[model samples]
Target: MRNQLPSSLHNGMMNYLSDLEWKQVLDSLQQGLCCCGANKYADWLHTPWIHVDFLRENSHTVLRYMRVDGRALPPVLPSSCCNPFSPTPCLHDPLQQQRSLSVWRDTPQTAIDTVFDKGCLDLILQPMVELLTAIPIVNGCCIALQLISGILLRYIYTSARNSVLVGDPGGKAYGWIFGRGDCRFALGSSLLDIDKKRAAKQKPSGNSGQESKEIGPRRHE
Candidate 1:
C-alpha cells in the first residue's frame, strides 16, 4: 500500500520529520513527566495510540517504549509508586525483583526518560497535524475524480444519443442513456456536495491561523 503512494505524497510524509527534529521529538518523549495523577498517566499512555497508528499508516517510523501488562512504565518512580496509598506495599517475589532489576539496569535512561516523561503524546501530535491537513486535499481529489467520471459518462451518452437521432427511426435507439447520465450526474453532484462539506469542516478557522502567527514571533524571544 505504501509503495502505491505517489512520490509527492511520500515526500509530504517525509517532510513531517527530519532526523534532527525526530530526535528532538524522541528526546521529548524520553523526558519523564512528574507523576502527579493517575489520570494524567492514563491519558499519557492511551491517547497516543491513535496518533501512533496514524503515523504508522502514513509510513512514518513510530517509536514506542516497552510495555508490561499493556501499561507503559514511568522513567523514575512516581510518588504513587514510591509511597502507595494502600496500607501494605505491593510485594514482588524475589525472582520478580531480580528480573525487574536486570531489565531496569539494561534499559537506557534516556529512552526510559523519554518514554516515562512524554509517553507517546508528543510523537502523536506531528502525525495528527499531518492527518488533519490531508483531509481537505483528499476530499478535493475525490471530487475531481468523480467530476471527471461524470463528464466522461455525459460525453458518452451525448454521442450515443446523437447516433440514435441520426440513424434509428425508433426514438428508443439509445435505450437508457439519458437516465444513466442523469443518475451519474446526480451521484457525482451528491458526492461533490458531501466532500465540500467535509472540506469545510476540515478547514481551520481564520482565528486559529491568526493566533498561530501571533504566537510565532513571541516564541523566539
Candidate 2:
C-alpha cells in the first residue's frame, strides 16, 4: 500500500488501505455483524497487504480451524463456459473433441500416451455458440424448415471453421467469413487442452531444477 500510492491516486482511485488504518478497521470488524464465511482462513487470500509470514503461519492454521469448526469453503473450478447449457460446436463431433481435451483418457500402454486438459475457456466458444442460435432466424426462408435448417447450417459453419473448407479464391482462406482466422488461436477444444497441459508443466514444482527441461511445446513422452 505504501509503495503503490502514486499510481492509485493519479488514476483517481482512493487508496483502499494504510497500515494503521487497516489495523484499526480489522479490530472493529472482528466485533461487527457481518459474517466473513466458512473458509475464514482462505478468505485472507482476498485481503490486500497480508504479510508473507502471516500467510505462511496462520494460513494453514486458519484452514485447519475452518475444517475443525465444520466451515466449508467454495471449491475452485475450471470453466470452459460451454456445456450442455451449450450443445453446439462442442457436441458437433464428439470423437474429435475428446482428442483435444481427453487425449489421455483413451491412451493404452501400447498407444502413444496423449491427453489434453485446457484450463481457461477459450474466447472462441461463446461466439460460435451464439452463432448457432442465430442461424435459423437469419435465413428465415420458411416457417416449417427454419428450425431444422438453422441446426444444419450451424453444423456446416462449424465444420467449415474447424477443418478449412479450402475451395475459396480471391485470396480468402476457407471459412474466412466464419472468422476462424481471428479466433483460430483464441481457442477450441483439443487445442485448448494442449495449451492447458503446456501451462501446467510450466508451473514451478518441487523439482525446480529439473523443471528447466520439462516444458515448452510437447510431444509424445
**Which predicted model would earn the best lDDT?**
1
Number of clashing residue pairs, candidate 2: 6
lDDT of 2 at 26: 37
Q: What would the per-residue lDDT of candidate 1 be over residues 1-221, giving only the tens digit for each residue?
A: 22333332223223323444533433343333323222233332232222222333322112233344443222233222222333433221112333444444475332233222322333434576788899999999999999888877876766566446445444322223344336455433332353456568879898998898887866445
| Residue-level error in angstroms, candidate 2, position 115 | 41
lDDT of each: 0.40, 0.34
TM-score for every candidate vs. truth?
0.27, 0.15
lDDT of 2: 0.34
Error in Å for residue 106 of model 2: 32
Off by over 4 Å in 1: 1-119, 168-221
Sliding window of 10 residues with minimal summed lDDT for model 1? 88-97
